[model samples]
Structure formats: C-alpha cells, structure tokens
Target: MRSPSIAAAASTAVLMTLASASRGQTTGGFSLDRFEPAPAGDAFFGVPSPAAPGHLAPRVHAMLDYAHRPIHSSGDSPIDLVSSQALLRLGASLALWDRLLLSLDAPLAVAQGGDDPGIPGVAFTELTAPELGDLRFGARLRVLGRDAGPLQLGIGGYLFAPTGTPAQYTGDEEPRGAFHASLGGRLGTARSSLGFLWSASGGVELGGGPNRPQQLTFGAAAGALLGGDLLQLGAEAYGAAPLGGDLLLSSTPVQREEAGLNAELLLGAKLRVLGGLTFGAAVGPGLTNAIGTPSVRAVGMIGWAPLPQPDSAERAPAVAAGDKDDDGIDDALDACPDVKGDPSPDPAMDGCPPADRDGDTVRDIDDACPTTPGARSADVTRSGCPDDRDGDGFHDGIDACLDVPGSSSDDPRKVGCPADADDDGIVDASDACPKVKGTASRDPKQNGCPDDPDGDGVRGAADACPNERGRPDPDPAQNGCPRFVRVHADEITTSKPVQFIVYGKTRAQTVAPISDDLLREVRDAIQQNPDIELVEVQGHTDDSGSEEYNLRLSQERAEAVLSWLVAAGVPREKLVARGYGFERPLGDNRVKTGRQKNRRVQFMIIKRKGAAVQR
Candidate 1:
C-alpha cells in the first residue's frame, strides 16, 4: 500500500463520474483528503503555539508530505481503496504587532493514485479526481499571554475554497469554514536543558451537504530540540469527527460507513541546519479506519526563512599582532626589541627592565633570592615580598588547597582546583593514590586508597611490612614486632633461655634471685591466652643428683616457679607444679651442655578452656 498509478485513479474517477450522473444527487460520503499543512509559527508539528514567528516581517514557507493509503480497506478486494498521494503545500503569512497573523496556503497533488477502475471506494467519489486541493485563507490572533508560557492562548479561523476534486480525494465539493483556538506552552531554549514546546487545537468545521459533512477537529503536538538546536523530535495527534447524519449508514454498496472521519497520530523528527533551513519527517498509525483515515501514515517537511545574522561590529582581516621580543609590547614600540621586558611609562625604558628571568616582580639586579621567587622583605637577605612555597603559580598566601599543586580555573570559586584523574571525587590534591580509583579514608596518607591487606591499618605504598601484619614503627627493620617471644600451641617458646639463681647443697633454684626479660614474656604469653585453663610448671634435675634428693629438689623448684608466676599476675589456679627429675631432657646428661639442658625448666599446656589449642 504505497503509491497507486495515475491511470488507475483517473480511470476510476471517470467511472465514478458516470455512476454519480446516473444517481443524480450528491452521493453519500468518502471524498476530500483530511490532511492540512500547519501554518508558520507551529509549536510542534501541526499544533500552533501562541507565538507569532514573523511578527516583524513576512515569512513564506513550503511543506511537502506523502500520505500512504489514507483511504484503505481491510477487505482484500483493493488493498488501497483510495489514493496514496504526494502533496506540496505552499503558504505565506504576515504577523502584525506580535498578535495577529494572516496566511494563505495552497496545496496540490503532484502525484496520486487510488483503487483500479471498479473498487467500492471509487464509486463513493461521485466526481472526477482533480490534481488540486482546497485553497486555505487563515488568520489568528493571540488573545492572552505576552510570551510563551504554560497558559498561552490563540484564536483563529480558516476559509477553504472549493478548488479541489472530491473524486480525487483531495477536498470537499463545496466551500467550508472553521473556527479554532489553541493553547500552548514553551519552556527553555534547548532540549538538553529539558527545553520543550507543546500546543493543542480544537475547532468546528461548518456547513455540510450530502458529499461533505460538518465536523469537529482537534489535535495536539509536543516536541523538544536536542543536540543543541540541530535536532528536533516531536509527536502530533489530530482527528475529525463527522457530525449529524454523516455517521449514519447510507444507501450504497460501500458497506455503510462511507462518511469520512480523520484521526491519525504521527511521530516526527526535524533537523535544523544552514541557519534558517529545517528538514523533517514523520510517521504513525491512523487511530480508526474512517473513510479518509489510513492504517498508517508518514510525512516529511522542510521550511526556510531569512537568517537573522548578527550585526557586524569589528570585522577586520585576521592579522597577527607584531611582538618581536615576545613581551606584552609590540616591536614597533619596544625600546629593546630583542629582549623581553616589563611595561614602563618612560619611552626610553619601555621594553627594558632589570631582567627578572623567572618573571617574579623582584628585578634580578636587586633580587636577594634571584632563582627562588620571593617578595620584598625588610631583611636584606630576603626581600619583603612573599615567597612561593608550593610553586603552584599562586603564592602560599592564595594557594587554597595548599597540600597539593593545582591548575588555575576560569571559575573563581575553584581558582586552583586540582584534577581527579581517577574520577573518584577525591582530587589529586589530597588523594594518596591519585591515578587509581579508590575510596576516602581518615588517614591522610591513605586517603583515596585501596584496602590494607595485612590488617595493620597501614595502607598504600607506605607500608614497609606489607606481607606481614605489624604495627607502625619508626624503625623499618623491627616493624613493631618482638624479636624473641612466640606463643606455640602447647607452650610459650623463647629464643633466649630463662635465667634463675641456683643455691643450696641440693642444687635448689629460685626465680626471685635472677630475672630475665624472657621470663616476663612467658608471663605475658600465659596472660594473653586466657583460654589456657591450666599450665603445668615442670622442673627437671641432672643424673648427678641422687634420685630421692633430686626429685625433692625438682618439686621445690617447680613450686617456687608457680609462686613467682602468681606474683607476676598469672592466676594461681591456672598453674600446677610438678617435678620429674631427669625423666625428660632435651640432651643427654653425659656432657656438660646436656647437664645444663637437663636442669632447665619448661612449661606445658595441660588443659584449655574449650578445645586443645592448635599451632
């Protein structure tokens, strides 16, 4: 259902004219094309807004559209019962004082087609099909609102002359008039900023006859411009309901509903280009299968007007200004063209000044800190001027985010805001790892950083002992971990042996007479592990002692150790004293080293709070 041949439509029209002559009176309905070109200043597609686009001058426009199968049938006899034609609409309008607008529009069918010689739709058009449509004389007046807003109103009227061929489905058989009012609104100037335009029109078509029906026409359109002002997208819906007997079934072979009622919704896209030129296209479904309503329709439009160019004020050929010395002054005016200089009031010194190579205000000849920028100071060694500490162009006095260097910005509030390369919201100024995306933290060194894997609270690249969990320490080697103490599953082990005093004839030993830091570590280990319900203090003696005396001496030494631990904050109930003289030794007692090892004390974990502790 696209274009139908002209020969088919022309032959159909001829047959229709002969059939109409036989019937005599104007047949029932199904004639005129329902589509109309929207006038200039249209807010969205076809809906007219209150604004007068050409209020200061006359504006002329032309629009072309191809309507597909405007009059079609679901019955397979003829896919398209009426013509699918192309219309070229030409219109001109003049708005007076921004309120009144008068327009003239002429529409012609450049190409058209309909059903073959004998379709039911052809009989309904009781006249010869013509290539022209009704000529429109239109006028409108804005009755309310001075500017485009939510509640602006415009009232208008249209007079259509009988310049069309009903047989061709382009217009009515007689003159018609319509009165309409439109309500509209326009917000913002750009679609990206949520700018939009909308309007709706309601009107009555008057004066009806057998071939033409009085009608109620209503429509609304909404649109927005995107891509700056280059693209516009919009949708429009308009429908007309035939009044009086037009809705009644006529005595015809057309299957009763011969009257035409127009209702179609269209979606359109428009492109604005080349200053004042606009090109657009649209397509949508016909809501109902009325006589002139199609199953679907498509439209394209283009408009143009004179471009309002900006008034030229300073239009001269682009020529680079001469500045040989690369200073602020031109070569013609520079006293020393080859050298850069500061501006001076005296002509002889215009481009020459004591060279401040670093561009500091202080002249190089009197500059105390020539390489380092410093302001003039009372002291001779340093000028009175301020110094640039961070060297971020701005002196420390004005470097707002002073911790990190930043670039200057056109925005006054963010004069030297730093960049956030990772886009993590933390600027490089305070971000410890600025190049990588991370979260913020309380630690300044770890701010905008990744997780601390060792659970030591140390983060980023600053952690020296990253693989091993340790506390923060000034000495990198120790890393806050002790050198000697290690808690094992069954006991506390130390790199150094515990020291004690040995006295008496039986070789009795007491911890009170000697002290070692490893002893304190053992006490701390037992205290730290509250789950160890009981720890046995074992004392052993070398083979040199007589069995009975050695056992007694060992028991005495074990008991003494328990008493010493209880005094050092180990619970008395958590300790059990026992002696096994020489029963278990780390080395044989035959050698001197073995004898010393055999006389040493060892603690054993006997019972834990819940389960046996695992190493």
Candidate 2:
C-alpha cells in the first residue's frame, strides 16, 4: 500500500502539471521532450547541436515552455487523461577552452492543472504546488570541424540533480546523467540571404529511479536564415525509446505497460537583435502515444551572449601602452608622438623628423638632396648639400661649374672661376685671350696668347705682323718688319695715290669690303721696287662735311690703307699711316660723282736720291 503523503504528492503533481499547461508553462527534468540551446537552428530541441569551436562566447538564456495534452492513453488502457503544464528555466553556457563548452540550467514549474485519480490503495490525492525543478550541468567538446568549416561534430554529457519537489511534477525525484554525440553543418550560402543550416544528434541516458529505464534519444533539425541570420525559421523531429525496463502500471491503476516511444515535430523561429540578443519561440505536436508526451507543446526563449572583453594581458603591448603614431615608440618616449618617425638617441629628435637614410643630420623632408651624403650648414639654401663631384672645395649646388674643379667664391661671376673655357690648361680668369686655343706663358700679359702662326719670335697679339715671317724690333711700331719694298722707277717718279669711296659720316666709322686685291697690288709693288727708300701714305677726301671732320676722316682713311698693306706681308718699318683731312681733291667737290672720286687715300713714293715725286 502507498503512504498518504506519497499519494497526496502524486495528486498534487497532476494538478500542478495541468495548471502549468493552462498558464503556458512546463516543468524541466530528465525528460525525452526537453530542449537544448545551440548555435544551429535545430538546437531548439533534442540534440547536442554542433557549433564551430570558439565561435561564441559565454551566454545566458531564459526560456518558458508550455505543454497541453488534450488526450493521452496510459499503456494499453483505453482510459484518457487531460493535462496542462508550464515551466520557466534559466541557463548559462560558456566556451571554456578551444573546443570545450560548459553549461548549467535550472527550471521552475510555475503552473499546472489536470484531473487526477487517487493512487491505488490510497486516498486524499487533492493537492496544490509550485516548485523548483532539477538542476542540469553539462560539458561539450568538439571532436571535429573548425570555426570556419562546414561540417561539425561534437560529443558531450549532462548531469541532472533532483532539486524539485515531487508535488510539482517538475523533477523525477532522482539523479540522472546523459552522454551524446552530435553532427551539424551549414549549407547553401553562408552570410548570404539564402543561407541554411542543419543539425542532428543522438544520445543515451542512464536512468536511475523507481520505474525509470535506460533510453535512446535522437533528433534532427533544419533551418533557413532570413534577413542575414537576424531571423531564423526551423523545424525539428525528435524521439526517445526505452532500451530495457520492467513493466509498471500507473499508481492510479489506469494502465500497465513498459516505457513507450515518445516523439514530437516542432517548428521554431528566432529573431536576433542588439547584435548579441536572441528571441525565439517554437510549437509542435506529439508524434507518439507515450503517456508523458503532450499532444501539443510550445516554447519561448530570450538569449544573450555579450561580446567578450579582451584581458589586459591578452592585448598587444604597443596598443595597451599607446603608440599614437604607430611607430613602435610609446608616447612618453616619442618627441613627436602624433607623427610617424624613427628611433634616435636624442630625446628631442627621436621620432621628431622623417627618416634620414644616409645618416645625414638633415631630415629627408627638408633635405633637397637626400640620397647622396652631405653636410649641414648655416646656409639654408645649401642645408642639404650634395657631394662635390669635381673635388672642388665648393659643393655641387653652390658651385656653378659642377664637373670641373673651380674656386669657392659665392659671387656669381667669380664662383666656379679659373675654368679653362677652351680647355687649354690655363684658367679662364687669368687667360688674357680666354676663348682662343693657346698655351701657358711666363709673361702675364701674353699668357694664353694664340700661337705665332708665322713662327715669328714675338707672340701673336704683340706681333705687328703676326701672320708673316719677320724679325723682332725694339720699337713697338716696327716690331715685325719685312726688309724692303720693291717698286717701279715710274711709280717712284711721281706721287702715286689710291682712291676710295667714303661711306661713313665720321672718320672713325668702320669700313666694309676693303679691297684685298688692291692691298695685294700695293704689296707687290713694294716688293718689286726694292730701290724705294721710303713711302708716304697721304689722305684726301671730298668736302662732304665740316672741314675739320673731313680732314680727320681723310687722314684715317690714309692710315687704314697703310695698315692694310703692312699686314699683307709688307715691311712695317717701310710703311707709315697718315690721315689727311679733306683738304685736297682731284675732282669737283660740289658734285656728288666728283665728291665720291675725291674721297680717296693717296700713297707717295720717294727714291734713294731723296727726291720727292709728284703725279
């Protein structure tokens, strides 16, 4: 016979179960119908759902479940019973390590109600109750699948503590444990609008309690993600079957049989919000005729998994200490902490300027010539001076003549001085005749003088007859002289005069197209008449301007003609240059044609007899 207390407790449990169902609540315990929260959509119930290892952090979950059994038969009996149940549960889970997870949960039977028959051979079965349920703790370890892989596998176990009162139908009044293995995976497009996932699990429970039996539990679920996983819809099918146990009848004597198979088909939806918060709900109907299985069940849950915070020790040292410029130097040690720079011994300069690749004191930013080695100087213009390519004391930029060695003066004209413009080995500034090709000379005035083309003893510039062979003379005027002038006796018998046309307005104006033939003729005459002792070059011009000017002009023309003949291999000592004003004319001065003829130079010849000749 059963004790009154036990009978009353059973009756109370039945009433509570019915009330809980009416209130949309269900009790939690070692039951085939319990749900497990997991990363996959199928995790709504009946499986050790596989998850990518370390993909999620610790989380807390709250769930409410309601179950209704409008009709249920016990064993082979035809009698039926109606009941409602409600339960609220709180749970937490954490990834303890690489592929390991630990979780704990507690449930409260909040409401239940149903019709109840007194226990066999017992009375006073009416009751009232709201009580705590079992405490569940579990660990899950991933056996396969990395965080980013499509296939995942895991094995785990759960321990249930009988923490509920029997009167509430919230617990089995005995401890229980379960071991499970699960496989899960995602299909379709991950992180896309059409992504999907599926999960499946199987496990065995070691039953320990009066009338309880060892059981096999298996489940599978599939889901589609809408709105990028913000919303999920899924369905699950799960079942449990007893492996072995003694046949037992209900304490009320309504039926007698061994444990039967229990199964359900559930559809669920979850909405993820606030990045880490998830709200979910599910409903399903029983698929079997098991005594304890409800005809319809529904569940609602809210879960949160706050993002993990990095520990100080786990954070990078540079980031933790603050490298504002990301230069690997902390702000405290960086002179220009906010700007990128380099390491240096000087506190004020370290990290303060851009890199200097050649170890030059000048930073590359301010160094105009950065690559080649240089020096710092007070001249800002040459602060980053390039190497002197010519081995000159002055560096490149300041030195105008870069490729050749020169002076160091900054004066535009003097700087880079002593350059050999003609490359004659003589420096240009000291070169009297810089442009002409020449040679070094001991005489400063004649230094860099052009070659003596005629092989004359004197240098070119100082030689009076530079292009002709001649002997040196003490007199500057007769320095390079030919011996004598040969002339015809008839030419010396009279004063011979050469005529010319005056083109310039002044006597000193330059003349164009002087007759080389005429000059050569005069030179030949001088060479032919060797008996001529002396020659006089006289000037005469037409009266075109003032008498004074005309006289000067005539005299210049005479001197020019004399110089021309002397330069054309004539004897310099035997020649004289004279300029006569326009005082004598051979033609009418007032006539344009006559004035042209009169504007002329005349040469006079004298014999060794000292007699002057007139033409």
Candidate 3:
C-alpha cells in the first residue's frame, strides 16, 4: 500500500516532463533539477598544477544563460497548460590544497506561464520564478589525476538550497531542495558525472501528508579542441529517473512518474589570451525532456580560469642528452674527446699509432733500434720500442765497438775495438811495439819503426854513436870526447853494466822489418855484462797496418830481444822486454829523421829498484 501523495508526486513529474517535450527548440546548460549538474564541466579547464614546483590558484567563472521549458498537456491534465523558464548561472573554483577543490554554483531562474483558463488571470499575474534555484555548493577531492593525462577524474558532493517554487508550482514536483552524491571521471577532452539525489519536501502529499522521492541522474560530455588544446567543442547528455513519487496532474491524479533527458552542445576555447590566464566560452542548445520527447534548449556561458604552473620534470631529460663525458662532447662525434686521457705517445703525432721508419712490428717513432726490426716496448726515448746492439748491456750509441759484444757495466776498456797503446801515432794493429813507447819512422803498414842505437833512450838521429849501445851517447862537442869503441866479450864483462840496443827494418817499403845489426849488437852487449842483474828491453815501431797487427809486430820484436839475450848466455830472468807499438816516440813522425828515431829499441841495466826508466 503506497501513499497517495507519493503516487500523485510521480504523476506530476510525468506532466512536467511531457510539457517540456510539447514545446520545441530550447537550449540551456544542464541544471540540477533537469540533469546531473556536474562539478562544473568547465572546472576541468583548470586542472591542478602539474606535479611540478608550483600551485594551481583560485579561479572564477561567470555565465549568463536562459532556457525555455515549454509544456503541453491533455485537456484533463492536472498541470497548467504550459510554462516557460529562463536561467542564469555563476560559479567559481577555489583550490583548498594540492588535492582538494571547493566550488560554488549560483543560478537565477525566471518563469512565464502559458495561457490556461483553469487558473484565473494566470497570464496577467507577475510570476517571479520562486527566487530561481538555490545556490549549489560542492567540493571535489582529487583522488588520482595528477599524472593521469587528459582523463581527469574526481568525486564530490553537492547541495542545492531550497529556492525553487514548491507551493505555487503544483505541476513542478521535486523542484527544490536536493542533495546529490556524485562520482565523476573524465576522458581526453571530456568529462562525466553520475549522481544519486535525495529529493526532500517537493512531491505531493501522501495519505493526507507530504511525500518525497529519490532520483538518479547520469551526465556525460565529450569534446575536442579545434586548435591545439585551445579551442573546444563539446556535447553533453543527461538522464534522470524519479524513484519514490509522482506528481498529481488531472483530477485523476495522472500517473506522472517518468524519466527526463537533456543535452547541451558547447563551444569553448582555452586561451593563454594573456599570461597565466585561461579564458573559455561555451554556447549550446540544451535538449530537455529528451528521453522520449527530446526538446532543444539554448545556453551561452563564458568562463575564465588560471593556467597551471609549468612542470620542472619535463626539462630534466633534455639536459642529460647534451653532454656525454659530462665534459660536453656529445659522444657520437667526439674525436679524441677524452680530455683527461694520458699524455700522448708523441707530442707531435697526437695520441695515435706512431710512425714506423723500418717495416718492423715496432713503430719507428718508438723503436730504439729504428733501423733494425725489434719488439714493441715502452722505451719512450726509442719511441716506445727496444733495441739491442752488440748483444751486450749497452745500446749501439754507447757501445764503442758496436759490432763486437761488449759490456758497458763490466770491462769497457778491455772489450772495445783495440787502439794504439804507445804515442807513436800508430794504432796497435800496425805498430811493431804495440805496448811499448816507439816512433813513427818506419812503414806504418807492418812494423812501425826500428830500434834505438844508443841505450841512452835516444835513437840514431839524436845519438852520437847511432850504432852502439850502453853509453852516454850525447853530442860529442857538448859532453863526450870518446870515439866508437869495438869491444870484445872481455871488455864488456858481466862484472860491469852494459847497454843493449835493437832496431827494426823492413824488406817491403810498406812492411817494416827488424834491424839485423841492431839485434846482434844488443845480444853481444848482454853477454859481456854479468853484473847486469836487471835488463829492460823495449821494442818500438811506427803506425802501420791495423792497430791490432802493429801491436803483434811490436810484441814479436821485443820477444826477439829476449831470445837473443838467452842465446848469449844471459839469464832470461835478468831481462824484462815489452812492446810499445807506436806510442812513445823520440821525434816528430812527419820527417825521415823522426821516422829513423821511432824505429829503435833500447835496453838498460837496473842498478837499483828505483832506476830511471829509459826509452
């Protein structure tokens, strides 16, 4: 058993809907009574500040609009013949925090009644439209749209104040006092809201008392921006159903429980039109009673919203791409771009493969043995390569005899290519007495020079007795009065000291030879001196042949002296013979007299250990 007032409320709802359909060509933005007036569809234009460093601020919106809701009814209809309506709406959005938004919607509605005889003077009366619809206050909590691209979403609750006609508005049921709970979401460039409303105190009385009904409304809109995201074109549709009651229409309480439908087409644009300011305009035709009998409603709206702050996160990726080493060269084309790399191989060649002179595996710039093939090494002076010469510890530049194996660390003087030991201007290879002092008189190719005649350490050119030995042998005018003495073995006795001289000659002009007379004279002198306890025989020559050959020749000449001494019955232990090949000299080597002076060897007795050394 349902209450009669509840039934009458249902019927009156049907009549209001039928009357709106009976009139055609009306347009307006959606209102709570007609459709699920969402958290203003335009509110989306002001999405929260991007998750960057700033805030979305306060926003204001104002809209002036009019809607004509025309009604047509049957003759027995309890509702008036018809009524037309006009509406104005204004609102604003204030950001409460990063996640919550507060909004207020105020509307002013004006109505003009249709001609009807059932109510007297209805056309002449001043109908003020019941103070229009009361202000709607709402709050939306942003749950998940910060990064959710164009599809913004939210949930909110709205309250409509009791400002619409209820007493005089017999045909208009559920026209005042509504509370709506809305669940809202959006797609790219589009928004939608669905709400369940509890209407209070607007339906007809039931069982001699007032009755109220609950309603459900779904609203949805989809739009596109014409130029960038700046200009927008959108269309919205809404459906609502009355649940608990109907309005009494005719005397029969015409069952008016019904559903209503409305739609609006909007044209809006988002413009920077200025700094940080976004302005939009919306003009559309709203359809009313559109579920079964759709009627067109007209609406015009203008709104201005603040633009969101720019996002800092969007700039991070660009900065990282410009630098590769973090040194600012974008690695793709960097050539030798590693500025902190090690020192270059060659200061002139840059840090690349060095130039190789020889076709060796080692680069020439780094190859110590640049002319010879060798291994790559880290010897920077040798262009980072290693070279071994003489098969010894020293490189070729320091090795005196590069061809021979020599030790730079050990016996350097003994191992290098040989040289003349004496000052006779001859290398040892060509000097007759290589180790002993000598002259440069004889042929330098073989034995360098002959021996000295007098044992006074002077050769024939400087000695008075050029053929004798063991005498003063000075200039006769200055220090001598004796002539040459031919001595027998008794005259030259062992009890007395005697002089021995040996000279060198050569058969070939280039091959110097030992002097036969000089050799015999020295042998005879030694045989007569038994008291000659100490004998020193030195061989001499001029530079000839190689230093090595000269040195051997001089050594052989000194040995000849020792052999002759032993044959003459002198003890071999009493004589010390040495070769000085072209080293010590008695005269200048450039002249024939000097050559003769360089060719002789002389012997002297050592009377004491400190005896003066004779040439």
Candidate 4:
C-alpha cells in the first residue's frame, strides 16, 4: 500500500503536468496554445509555444493525452516510482481584435495509477477514480508582431479556479493568478524550405493555497520545420522554483523546487484536412529527472474555425443564375453581362461598350460629337472628338479646306471657306479651271471661265470636250469635240471590285447577276476608248468548299459578268473572262468579314500598242 502523502504527491505531479500542458507552457502535459507547425497548419495536440502565430478567427481545440513514467522520485523516497496518467482537455481561443486573444481551458483527469508508498503528504492510494481538473482562463495580448516578423512579444495573465477534487490531485483547491511575458522569434528563413523557432516565457504565480506558493516559473522551447513545414521536431525545457512560501509538499514538489530543470524531446505533425479544420498528433519522451515529467507522452487533437468555410450552407441559395444582356453568356461568368456583346479575352471589355452604338472606338458617353465618325486619340481635347486636322471647329469630314483652318459655316459644300487656288471668286470645287482665274458668265457651265487648252474658240469651262479642238457650234454642248476617242488604264481599274448578286439552288455554282451601274461604266469606258483592245474580267472567291467547285463557279461567274457587259453594249471582241478561284483570296478566309471581302470580280484593262498602261 502507498502512503497517502506519496500518492498525493505523485498525483499532484500528474496534475501539474496536465496544467502546464493546458496552459501552453512546456513544463509538462501538452500545451494547448497556438503553435503553427506549418505556415497554414497549426499545432492541434500541443499547446502553442509563446512564439506561435496569432490568428484572426476563433478556434476550438480538443486534445487527449496519455503519459507514462517508468521511473520517478519524490525526494522522500529512495525507491523509483512508476505511474501512468491520462488527460482530456478542451480549449478555445478567440482573437478579439488585432493581436489580442482570449482563451479558456478545461481538463478531465480520466485515469491515473502508480505504486504508492503511503508517504505523509500523499492524498490517495492507488488511482481508481476519474474527476474534473481545474479551469484556467487567460488573455494574451501581443505587444510586437502578430502574424509575421523576426521577433514576437506578448504579455498574458491567467486565473485558475479550484474545480476538481483535491483529494485526487486534480487541482490545488484554491484560486491562483499568474502574469507572464513571452518573447519568441523565428530563425533561418520562413521563405526557405527549412526554418526554426525559439520561444521563452517567465512569470510569477500569486496565491495563498498550500499548492499555490508564490513561485517563479519559466520555460523555453525550440522547434524546426521539416519536410516543407509538414513536420515539426523540437525540444523544451521548463520548471518552477519556489521563491518564498510555506513548503507545499505535494503541489510544489511535482513541478520541482529551487532550481530543478525538466527537458523533453518532441515530434509532431499537423495537417489541414479542411478549410479551417486541422488535425495533429505529437509524441515525446522526457530526458531529465523531474517530479512531474513523464517518461513518454502522446497527444491527439482536432481544431476548427468556422469563418474559413465559403461553401457553407449559410451562404448558399443566395446567388441567382440569369443573363441580363442576352448575349448567350451567363451573368455569373460574364464580366459585363449587362450589355450584349461577343466573348472577349479582356474582362473589362468582355462586352460591347453600351454608349458606342455604332461600334466606333469612342464611347458615346464621352464623345462630344457622337453622331459623326471620328478617330480615337489620347490628346485630352481631341479624344472622342471629330477629326479637325487644322484645329478648326469644323471636322475634316465636312471641311472643304481640310489642310487649312477656316470659320465654320452652314453651307454643306462651302465648309472651311473653300479655297480659291487661282484667286477666283468661285471655290475650287465649283471652278472648272481652279488653277487659273476666270470670268463669270450667265451660263452655269461658264460661271467659272478658263483659257481653252484646245483653242476651240469656246471657253474651256463651257466646252464639253475641253482637251480637243473642234468647230464652234451653236449648241454649247457641242462647242468642243474630239475626232477620235482615248481612255486611260486607271479609268478602267478601280479600287472597289464590281460586285455581283448571285442567285441559284447551290450557292457556290450559282450564276451571279451583274449590276447595271457596273455594266454602264464598263460600256462607257470601252466606247470612249476605241483603241482599247481587250478587257479581262477576273473572278475570285474565298477558300471554302471544294477547290475544283470554286474554280468552276468562279469561271462561270466571270463569264456571266462579261456576258452581261456585252449585252449592255460592250463588243464581245474586247472582253475576255477568267477565274482564279480560292487561290486569289485578298483576305483571311477564317473570319466572316475577311471572307466577305475576298469574293470579288476584278477588271484589268489590256491596251494595244501606243496606248499608255497605268501599271
């Protein structure tokens, strides 16, 4: 049978270990404070060292600990003592604001056992009962760094209440208070794969209970992050030395007296299983002879914070699915879903600009002259404004003298004070001989007169054929005439192709109808230029469908156009039709707009000897 004093003392040691662990001190038991094993994963089963990181959210942690001591001594006995203890602790902490944290911990002594010698101060024989432990509440305020820094500092105070059966060594059976300051920091680089942390704390307890002597306690811990912060291996050394008080045999001896030191080698792992839930485990063995230090200790824990979950039920059912723009894209995925537009890679421009109805680069909301077409520019005064090359109020589109500044006017044809190059009263646009001054006449055609280049007797402005000399006729239209006709190559070839509207059962093989306006132009050109021998009408199409089919279609279309021209008035001998098909695409066929421009008919003027060719 063990002495009551010895049993009490050993049990007290077990209780002390449990208390230290719950308080996040390294003395014994499992510290339930906040220690981050990884940057994102915190220690779940052990009290965080003073150097641990601070959190922004509230967290609850629960841990189960099992400790076994193969050998221990209480100074009263020369024989070695053996014991086992189990503790269940529940702790919660919340960061009230900034770096301030409030925490509470409660533990239950599930089981305890050992060889008892019935020492004088022992309170119980063999362990056979389970009971509640003391309750500890604390507030920690970080004075220095909270989340990240080379060094972190904090000050904290805790209150302990007698809530357990003292006979079972669960508590001191009295109220006690303690104040402490902690300084900790990280060594090596957190940015590096491997790093280390060092923490130390010291404080004094104040109370009058037999177990609550006014003593000083201090602890230090060092740990290293391994395997990319997945594992933490460290060591801790801590103890309490009585300063001045009546000798409290049970409580004080369990934590060591005067200047005794306890050491432990620890290993732990933490895993972030969910958004804000973490699970961890730690196991270690004591390396020094200390009253409360256990030979081997193991702990398992689970921690959770509610605020990190975004997909929780609380947030569901509040979002709606709809498309406001009717652009085939949903509002949830569209950047500018309110306005209809095609898909674009840029999020800001994912939809069409609402105010730019005409698809102009300038937005109508900022465009001063919204109705008119203009260029986009970075110049503050000119941006979104109509092009006024000469800084004149009138836009170039309406200004007759585009290169010179002039006053604005209501006349549509006389914008920018239409220039008279020859100093003629009439503007260049109205003057037939703009470079030479002329006299006005009653005839509208002769209003702006000029010298007759052909010496046709009639003025150049009134002569129908100013370049050719002819006998003056009574009728103004036939005053000047040319005996033979001539035409320039440039007059036949135009920038815009002759468009044909095709209609048939098959789009590719359809016979296209030539425009009457185009036919008239071709006929007039041939008639005026009697010297022109041949005119080749070439047809081309975009790359689509069968190449052979496109070639045949192109040839047929070219022939159709030439036939229409011939029927309109052009002689067959002067016309030749050919097809280049999809091989002569003028633009990219992959896009809709490019393909539209690629389908066209081209006119090439072939002149005989002595006739000038523009090319």
Compare the candidates by lDDT and give the number of the best one. Answer: 1
Give the C-alpha lDDT of model 1: 0.64
- lDDT by residue for model 3 (436-499), tens: 3456755542254446633546443333333334445355322211232333212321221122
TM-score of every candidate: 0.46, 0.45, 0.37, 0.41
Per-residue accuracy of model 2 over 10-56 as CA lDDT, tens digit each: 33332222222222223222232244444322245444566623444
Q: Give the C-alpha lDDT of model 4.
A: 0.59
- RMSD (CA, Å), each prediction: 29.8, 40.8, 44.3, 27.9
Residues forming the 10-long window of minimal summed lDDT in candidate 2: 20-29
Model 3 alpha-carbon miss at residue 369, Å: 34
TM for candidate 4 is 0.41
| Predictions in order: lDDT | 0.64, 0.61, 0.43, 0.59
lDDT at residue 511 of model 2 (Cα atoms): 34
lDDT by residue (1-615, candidate 1, tens digit) is: 112342233233322222343356554333345676677535455666665543565766677767677655442234454557677788777777868888888988777665544636434443232377888999988889755445689999999887776555566667889889988876553323345778889999886345566888899998885654567688999988777444211333322333445788889987777775777788888887665666667677677643322112213233345778776666766788777765576878787756775566777656665555667766665562355556666555455666566777554444445877556899877877664467898888778766654456655645543323446777754443334555556875556555555432332235634444556666876876678888888888888758888888788888877877887788889999999987787865544567777886778887789875554
Best by TM-score: 1
Off by over 4 Å in 1: 1-18, 22-31, 76-79, 117-130, 190-193, 247-261, 305-615
Cα lDDT of model 4 by residue, 47-79, tens digit: 233433335666787777776763355554533
Clashes of 2: 32
User: How far is 279's C-alpha from truth in model 3 (Å)?
Assistant: 5.6
On a 0 to 100 scale, what is the lDDT of residue 458 in model 1? 59
